[model samples]
Target: MWPRMDGIRVLELGTPGELRTELTELTLSGAKTATAGLPALDYDAEREAVEHVGERLVLVDDSGMRAGEVEVTRVELVPFGEVGWEFARAEGEGYTSVGHWRESHRRYWEGQGCEVGDDTTIVCLWFRLV
Candidate 1:
Protein backbone atom coordinates (compact mmCIF):
# COMPACT_ATOMS: atom_id res chain seq x y z
CA MET A 1 0.00 0.00 0.00
CA TRP A 2 1.08 3.59 -0.56
CA PRO A 3 1.74 5.99 2.27
CA ARG A 4 -0.72 8.64 3.35
CA MET A 5 -0.17 11.92 5.13
CA ASP A 6 -2.88 13.01 7.55
CA GLY A 7 -5.28 10.63 5.83
CA ILE A 8 -4.74 12.22 2.44
CA ARG A 9 -3.23 10.08 -0.25
CA VAL A 10 0.38 10.73 -1.20
CA LEU A 11 1.15 11.69 -4.80
CA GLU A 12 4.53 10.51 -5.99
CA LEU A 13 5.68 11.42 -9.45
CA GLY A 14 7.82 9.12 -11.55
CA THR A 15 10.39 7.38 -9.34
CA PRO A 16 12.44 8.17 -6.29
CA GLY A 17 15.37 9.82 -8.06
CA GLU A 18 16.01 12.48 -10.67
CA LEU A 19 12.67 11.97 -12.39
CA ARG A 20 10.73 12.47 -9.19
CA THR A 21 12.77 15.53 -8.28
CA GLU A 22 12.22 17.11 -11.69
CA LEU A 23 8.50 16.40 -11.66
CA THR A 24 8.11 17.67 -8.11
CA GLU A 25 9.88 20.86 -9.01
CA LEU A 26 7.67 21.33 -12.03
CA THR A 27 4.54 20.94 -9.94
CA LEU A 28 5.80 23.33 -7.32
CA SER A 29 6.67 25.88 -9.95
CA GLY A 30 3.15 25.67 -11.38
CA ALA A 31 4.55 24.47 -14.71
CA LYS A 32 2.84 21.12 -14.30
CA THR A 33 -0.81 20.80 -13.50
CA ALA A 34 -1.47 17.34 -14.81
CA THR A 35 -0.05 13.87 -14.94
CA ALA A 36 -0.83 10.47 -16.44
CA GLY A 37 -1.11 7.08 -14.88
CA LEU A 38 -1.85 3.50 -15.85
CA PRO A 39 -5.06 2.67 -14.05
CA ALA A 40 -4.48 -1.03 -14.20
CA LEU A 41 -1.13 -0.71 -12.50
CA ASP A 42 -1.63 2.39 -10.39
CA TYR A 43 -5.16 1.99 -9.09
CA ASP A 44 -6.50 -1.49 -9.69
CA ALA A 45 -3.24 -3.23 -8.99
CA GLU A 46 -2.66 -1.18 -5.90
CA ARG A 47 -6.23 -1.36 -4.65
CA GLU A 48 -6.49 2.44 -4.57
CA ALA A 49 -9.36 4.51 -5.79
CA VAL A 50 -8.93 6.71 -8.84
CA GLU A 51 -8.47 10.40 -8.14
CA HIS A 52 -11.66 12.39 -8.53
CA VAL A 53 -12.50 16.03 -9.03
CA GLY A 54 -11.90 18.12 -5.90
CA GLU A 55 -9.87 15.41 -4.27
CA ARG A 56 -6.90 16.70 -2.34
CA LEU A 57 -3.59 14.90 -2.20
CA VAL A 58 -0.27 15.45 -0.55
CA LEU A 59 2.51 15.87 -3.06
CA VAL A 60 5.63 14.04 -2.05
CA ASP A 61 9.22 14.54 -3.12
CA ASP A 62 11.74 11.95 -4.23
CA SER A 63 12.50 11.08 -0.66
CA GLY A 64 8.81 10.54 0.10
CA MET A 65 8.61 13.79 2.04
CA ARG A 66 5.68 16.08 1.67
CA ALA A 67 6.55 19.01 -0.58
CA GLY A 68 3.16 20.55 -1.19
CA GLU A 69 -0.56 19.90 -1.71
CA VAL A 70 -2.71 19.57 -4.80
CA GLU A 71 -6.36 19.24 -5.55
CA VAL A 72 -7.52 17.18 -8.47
CA THR A 73 -9.52 19.21 -10.93
CA ARG A 74 -10.36 16.55 -13.49
CA VAL A 75 -9.94 12.91 -14.22
CA GLU A 76 -10.49 11.17 -17.51
CA LEU A 77 -9.86 7.76 -18.89
CA VAL A 78 -8.39 8.46 -22.28
CA PRO A 79 -7.11 6.00 -24.82
CA PHE A 80 -3.39 6.21 -25.28
CA GLY A 81 -3.77 7.24 -28.90
CA GLU A 82 -6.61 9.61 -28.07
CA VAL A 83 -4.64 11.80 -25.71
CA GLY A 84 -4.80 15.37 -26.96
CA TRP A 85 -2.07 17.99 -27.25
CA GLU A 86 -3.56 20.19 -24.54
CA PHE A 87 -3.14 17.57 -21.86
CA ALA A 88 0.25 16.58 -23.20
CA ARG A 89 1.48 20.14 -22.96
CA ALA A 90 -0.01 20.52 -19.50
CA GLU A 91 2.34 17.78 -18.37
CA GLY A 92 5.11 20.40 -18.59
CA GLU A 93 7.64 17.96 -19.94
CA GLY A 94 8.46 20.23 -22.87
CA TYR A 95 7.31 17.80 -25.51
CA THR A 96 7.57 19.25 -28.97
CA SER A 97 4.53 17.35 -30.15
CA VAL A 98 2.01 14.72 -29.25
CA GLY A 99 4.08 12.19 -31.13
CA HIS A 100 7.02 12.97 -28.91
CA TRP A 101 4.95 12.53 -25.78
CA ARG A 102 3.48 9.31 -27.06
CA GLU A 103 6.83 7.82 -27.97
CA SER A 104 8.41 8.86 -24.71
CA HIS A 105 5.53 7.47 -22.68
CA ARG A 106 5.54 4.29 -24.71
CA ARG A 107 9.17 3.72 -23.91
CA TYR A 108 8.69 4.56 -20.24
CA TRP A 109 5.72 2.28 -19.75
CA GLU A 110 7.34 -0.49 -21.72
CA GLY A 111 10.45 -0.16 -19.60
CA GLN A 112 8.23 -0.61 -16.57
CA GLY A 113 7.24 -3.99 -18.06
CA CYS A 114 3.83 -3.03 -19.35
CA GLU A 115 2.88 -3.88 -22.93
CA VAL A 116 1.44 -0.58 -24.07
CA GLY A 117 -0.61 -0.13 -27.21
CA ASP A 118 -2.92 2.39 -28.83
CA ASP A 119 -5.89 0.93 -26.98
CA THR A 120 -4.36 1.14 -23.54
CA THR A 121 -6.31 3.24 -21.09
CA ILE A 122 -4.46 6.18 -19.59
CA VAL A 123 -5.63 7.96 -16.50
CA CYS A 124 -5.45 11.62 -17.39
CA LEU A 125 -5.42 13.43 -14.06
CA TRP A 126 -5.41 17.20 -13.76
CA PHE A 127 -4.61 18.95 -10.52
CA ARG A 128 -3.92 22.38 -9.09
CA LEU A 129 -1.36 23.14 -6.44
CA VAL A 130 -2.83 24.30 -3.18
Candidate 2:
Protein backbone atom coordinates (compact mmCIF):
# COMPACT_ATOMS: atom_id res chain seq x y z
CA MET A 1 0.00 0.00 0.00
CA TRP A 2 1.09 3.58 -0.56
CA PRO A 3 2.04 5.71 2.39
CA ARG A 4 -0.06 8.63 3.50
CA MET A 5 0.77 12.15 2.36
CA ASP A 6 2.14 12.85 5.84
CA GLY A 7 1.84 16.59 5.43
CA ILE A 8 4.02 16.40 2.36
CA ARG A 9 2.45 16.98 -0.99
CA VAL A 10 4.17 18.12 -4.17
CA LEU A 11 2.46 19.20 -7.32
CA GLU A 12 4.28 18.75 -10.59
CA LEU A 13 2.69 20.57 -13.48
CA GLY A 14 3.41 19.84 -17.11
CA THR A 15 1.53 19.02 -20.28
CA PRO A 16 1.02 15.58 -21.75
CA GLY A 17 2.39 16.78 -25.05
CA GLU A 18 5.35 18.29 -23.26
CA LEU A 19 6.00 15.13 -21.26
CA ARG A 20 5.75 13.06 -24.40
CA THR A 21 8.07 15.44 -26.17
CA GLU A 22 10.61 15.18 -23.38
CA LEU A 23 10.30 11.44 -23.40
CA THR A 24 10.78 11.44 -27.13
CA GLU A 25 13.91 13.57 -26.91
CA LEU A 26 15.25 11.48 -24.06
CA THR A 27 14.63 8.31 -25.98
CA LEU A 28 16.36 9.76 -29.02
CA SER A 29 19.27 10.72 -26.79
CA GLY A 30 19.14 7.38 -24.97
CA ALA A 31 16.62 7.85 -22.17
CA LYS A 32 15.05 4.70 -23.63
CA THR A 33 12.03 4.07 -21.38
CA ALA A 34 9.73 5.29 -18.69
CA THR A 35 11.43 6.37 -15.47
CA ALA A 36 10.00 3.02 -14.27
CA GLY A 37 12.52 1.16 -16.39
CA LEU A 38 10.55 0.59 -19.54
CA PRO A 39 12.36 0.39 -22.88
CA ALA A 40 10.41 3.05 -24.82
CA LEU A 41 11.63 4.14 -28.18
CA ASP A 42 10.20 5.39 -31.46
CA TYR A 43 10.07 9.12 -31.05
CA ASP A 44 8.00 9.39 -34.17
CA ALA A 45 5.32 7.30 -32.56
CA GLU A 46 5.35 9.15 -29.22
CA ARG A 47 2.31 11.30 -30.02
CA GLU A 48 0.13 8.24 -30.42
CA ALA A 49 1.73 6.65 -27.40
CA VAL A 50 1.12 9.73 -25.29
CA GLU A 51 -2.50 9.83 -26.33
CA HIS A 52 -2.81 6.16 -25.36
CA VAL A 53 -1.03 6.63 -22.02
CA GLY A 54 -3.09 9.67 -21.06
CA GLU A 55 -1.49 12.42 -18.92
CA ARG A 56 -0.49 11.00 -15.56
CA LEU A 57 2.73 9.24 -14.51
CA VAL A 58 2.98 8.00 -10.93
CA LEU A 59 6.19 7.72 -8.95
CA VAL A 60 6.45 5.27 -6.05
CA ASP A 61 8.96 5.34 -3.22
CA ASP A 62 11.15 2.45 -2.12
CA SER A 63 8.81 1.75 0.78
CA GLY A 64 5.94 1.50 -1.72
CA MET A 65 4.80 5.01 -0.95
CA ARG A 66 3.36 7.27 -3.59
CA ALA A 67 5.78 9.99 -2.61
CA GLY A 68 4.55 12.50 -5.15
CA GLU A 69 3.15 13.06 -8.59
CA VAL A 70 3.87 15.39 -11.51
CA GLU A 71 1.18 16.74 -13.80
CA VAL A 72 2.01 17.64 -17.32
CA THR A 73 1.52 21.38 -17.33
CA ARG A 74 2.89 22.15 -20.76
CA VAL A 75 4.28 20.34 -23.75
CA GLU A 76 7.10 21.71 -25.87
CA LEU A 77 9.99 20.33 -27.88
CA VAL A 78 13.23 22.01 -26.95
CA PRO A 79 16.84 21.52 -27.98
CA PHE A 80 18.07 20.83 -24.47
CA GLY A 81 20.34 17.88 -25.01
CA GLU A 82 22.78 18.50 -22.19
CA VAL A 83 21.80 15.30 -20.41
CA GLY A 84 22.40 13.28 -23.53
CA TRP A 85 25.63 15.07 -24.20
CA GLU A 86 26.89 14.32 -20.72
CA PHE A 87 25.86 10.70 -21.01
CA ALA A 88 27.71 10.28 -24.28
CA ARG A 89 30.80 11.95 -22.86
CA ALA A 90 30.80 9.69 -19.83
CA GLU A 91 30.29 6.58 -21.90
CA GLY A 92 33.00 7.59 -24.35
CA GLU A 93 35.37 8.06 -21.42
CA GLY A 94 34.72 4.49 -20.23
CA TYR A 95 32.00 5.11 -17.66
CA THR A 96 29.16 2.62 -17.31
CA SER A 97 25.97 3.67 -19.07
CA VAL A 98 24.00 3.04 -15.89
CA GLY A 99 26.36 5.24 -13.92
CA HIS A 100 26.18 7.86 -16.61
CA TRP A 101 22.40 7.86 -16.54
CA ARG A 102 22.34 7.98 -12.74
CA GLU A 103 24.75 10.88 -12.62
CA SER A 104 22.85 12.63 -15.35
CA HIS A 105 19.59 12.20 -13.45
CA ARG A 106 21.25 13.46 -10.29
CA ARG A 107 22.62 16.49 -12.04
CA TYR A 108 19.30 17.12 -13.67
CA TRP A 109 17.54 17.16 -10.30
CA GLU A 110 20.33 19.09 -8.66
CA GLY A 111 20.16 21.68 -11.39
CA GLN A 112 16.54 22.12 -10.48
CA GLY A 113 17.47 22.37 -6.77
CA CYS A 114 15.04 19.67 -5.72
CA GLU A 115 15.58 17.95 -2.38
CA VAL A 116 14.20 14.91 -0.64
CA GLY A 117 14.33 13.56 2.89
CA ASP A 118 16.75 10.78 3.87
CA ASP A 119 13.97 8.19 4.04
CA THR A 120 11.93 9.64 1.23
CA THR A 121 11.78 8.48 -2.34
CA ILE A 122 10.80 10.73 -5.25
CA VAL A 123 8.43 9.60 -7.91
CA CYS A 124 7.38 11.81 -10.85
CA LEU A 125 3.81 11.27 -12.02
CA TRP A 126 2.22 13.22 -14.84
CA PHE A 127 -1.54 13.72 -15.00
CA ARG A 128 -4.26 16.32 -14.86
CA LEU A 129 -5.32 16.81 -11.23
CA VAL A 130 -8.31 18.98 -12.02
Candidate 3:
Protein backbone atom coordinates (compact mmCIF):
# COMPACT_ATOMS: atom_id res chain seq x y z
CA MET A 1 0.00 0.00 0.00
CA TRP A 2 2.91 2.38 0.52
CA PRO A 3 4.38 2.54 -2.97
CA ARG A 4 1.16 1.71 -4.86
CA MET A 5 3.42 0.99 -7.88
CA ASP A 6 0.85 2.68 -10.08
CA GLY A 7 -0.45 6.21 -9.43
CA ILE A 8 -0.55 9.38 -7.24
CA ARG A 9 2.78 9.23 -5.41
CA VAL A 10 4.70 11.37 -2.96
CA LEU A 11 7.29 14.12 -3.09
CA GLU A 12 10.51 12.97 -4.70
CA LEU A 13 13.33 13.84 -2.34
CA GLY A 14 16.41 12.88 -4.35
CA THR A 15 17.62 13.23 -7.89
CA PRO A 16 17.18 10.80 -10.78
CA GLY A 17 20.06 8.44 -10.16
CA GLU A 18 22.59 7.05 -7.75
CA LEU A 19 21.93 9.47 -4.93
CA ARG A 20 18.24 8.70 -5.06
CA THR A 21 18.84 4.99 -5.10
CA GLU A 22 21.22 5.12 -2.17
CA LEU A 23 18.98 7.34 -0.06
CA THR A 24 15.87 5.27 -0.69
CA GLU A 25 17.70 2.08 0.15
CA LEU A 26 19.04 3.59 3.30
CA THR A 27 15.60 4.71 4.34
CA LEU A 28 14.13 1.31 3.65
CA SER A 29 16.83 -0.40 5.64
CA GLY A 30 16.39 2.03 8.53
CA ALA A 31 20.04 2.99 8.44
CA LYS A 32 19.36 6.50 7.36
CA THR A 33 17.35 8.50 9.85
CA ALA A 34 18.44 11.90 8.67
CA THR A 35 19.07 14.01 5.58
CA ALA A 36 20.24 17.48 4.66
CA GLY A 37 19.52 19.97 1.95
CA LEU A 38 20.18 23.53 1.07
CA PRO A 39 17.52 26.10 1.92
CA ALA A 40 18.30 27.95 -1.28
CA LEU A 41 16.52 25.59 -3.64
CA ASP A 42 14.60 27.40 -6.34
CA TYR A 43 11.49 25.21 -6.23
CA ASP A 44 11.39 24.51 -2.48
CA ALA A 45 9.86 27.80 -1.33
CA GLU A 46 12.72 28.58 1.05
CA ARG A 47 12.59 25.03 2.43
CA GLU A 48 9.93 25.93 4.97
CA ALA A 49 8.37 22.44 5.05
CA VAL A 50 10.90 21.19 7.59
CA GLU A 51 9.49 23.57 10.17
CA HIS A 52 6.55 21.26 10.61
CA VAL A 53 7.35 18.23 12.68
CA GLY A 54 5.77 14.88 11.86
CA GLU A 55 5.46 15.69 8.18
CA ARG A 56 5.65 12.63 5.98
CA LEU A 57 7.70 12.32 2.80
CA VAL A 58 7.64 9.52 0.30
CA LEU A 59 10.97 8.61 -1.11
CA VAL A 60 10.87 8.25 -4.87
CA ASP A 61 13.30 6.30 -6.94
CA ASP A 62 14.93 7.42 -10.18
CA SER A 63 12.35 5.45 -12.13
CA GLY A 64 9.59 7.66 -10.69
CA MET A 65 8.40 5.09 -8.22
CA ARG A 66 7.80 5.12 -4.50
CA ALA A 67 10.67 3.57 -2.60
CA GLY A 68 9.83 4.35 1.01
CA GLU A 69 8.45 6.93 3.44
CA VAL A 70 9.63 8.88 6.45
CA GLU A 71 8.45 11.46 8.94
CA VAL A 72 10.28 14.49 10.08
CA THR A 73 11.20 14.18 13.74
CA ARG A 74 13.58 17.09 14.20
CA VAL A 75 14.95 19.96 12.17
CA GLU A 76 17.88 22.24 12.66
CA LEU A 77 19.97 24.71 10.73
CA VAL A 78 23.65 24.14 10.91
CA PRO A 79 26.64 25.54 9.15
CA PHE A 80 28.08 23.31 6.45
CA GLY A 81 31.36 23.15 8.28
CA GLU A 82 29.71 22.76 11.63
CA VAL A 83 27.41 19.77 11.10
CA GLY A 84 28.01 17.56 14.10
CA TRP A 85 29.30 14.01 13.89
CA GLU A 86 26.14 12.65 15.45
CA PHE A 87 24.06 14.03 12.60
CA ALA A 88 26.58 12.87 10.04
CA ARG A 89 26.45 9.38 11.45
CA ALA A 90 22.71 9.38 11.24
CA GLU A 91 22.91 10.14 7.52
CA GLY A 92 24.06 6.54 6.99
CA GLU A 93 26.50 7.54 4.33
CA GLY A 94 29.34 5.71 6.10
CA TYR A 95 31.16 8.94 6.77
CA THR A 96 34.18 8.19 8.87
CA SER A 97 34.39 11.75 10.04
CA VAL A 98 32.76 15.13 9.78
CA GLY A 99 35.41 16.15 7.27
CA HIS A 100 34.25 13.39 4.96
CA TRP A 101 30.67 14.55 5.25
CA ARG A 102 31.65 18.10 4.46
CA GLU A 103 33.61 17.08 1.39
CA SER A 104 30.88 14.85 0.10
CA HIS A 105 28.25 17.49 0.69
CA ARG A 106 30.46 20.07 -0.90
CA ARG A 107 30.67 17.95 -4.01
CA TYR A 108 26.93 17.41 -4.05
CA TRP A 109 26.24 21.11 -3.56
CA GLU A 110 28.62 21.96 -6.34
CA GLY A 111 26.72 19.61 -8.58
CA GLN A 112 23.63 21.64 -7.73
CA GLY A 113 25.37 24.84 -8.84
CA CYS A 114 26.02 25.97 -5.29
CA GLU A 115 29.43 26.69 -3.83
CA VAL A 116 29.72 25.33 -0.32
CA GLY A 117 31.79 27.09 2.28
CA ASP A 118 32.38 26.79 5.97
CA ASP A 119 29.46 29.07 6.80
CA THR A 120 26.88 27.64 4.44
CA THR A 121 23.57 27.01 6.13
CA ILE A 122 22.29 23.47 5.72
CA VAL A 123 18.88 22.20 6.72
CA CYS A 124 19.43 19.11 8.79
CA LEU A 125 16.43 16.84 9.04
CA TRP A 126 16.02 13.89 11.37
CA PHE A 127 13.30 11.49 10.44
CA ARG A 128 11.81 8.09 11.21
CA LEU A 129 10.86 5.49 8.67
CA VAL A 130 7.19 4.74 8.59
Q: What's the candidate order when arranged by decreasing lDDT?
A: 1, 3, 2
lDDT of 1 by residue, 1-130 (tens): 6689999999999977999999999999999999999977788888998989999999999988899999999999999999999999999999999999999999988888887899999999999999
Lowest lDDT 10-mer window, candidate 3? 1-10
Kindly report which residue pairs in candidate 3 clash with one another: none
- Count of backbone clashes, every candidate in sequence: 0, 15, 0
Report the lDDT tens digits of candidate 2 across residue range 18-83: 654444344334333233111122122232222223444443333334534434433322222322
* Number of the predicted model whose lDDT against the real structure is largest: 1
Better of 1 and 3 by lDDT: 1
Total residue pair clashes for candidate 3: 0
Regions of candidate 2 where Cα sits further than 4 Å from its true position:
1-22, 25-31, 36-96, 116-120, 124-130
Return the candidate ranking by TM-score, descending.
1, 3, 2
Output the better candidate (2/3) by lDDT.
3
Q: What is the lDDT of candidate 1?
A: 0.93
lDDT of each: 0.93, 0.34, 0.76
Residues 64-90, model 3: lDDT tens digits: 766776778998888888899999999
Error (Å) of candidate 3 at residue 48 is 5.5
Residue 55 CA error for candidate 2 (Å)?
Answer: 9.1
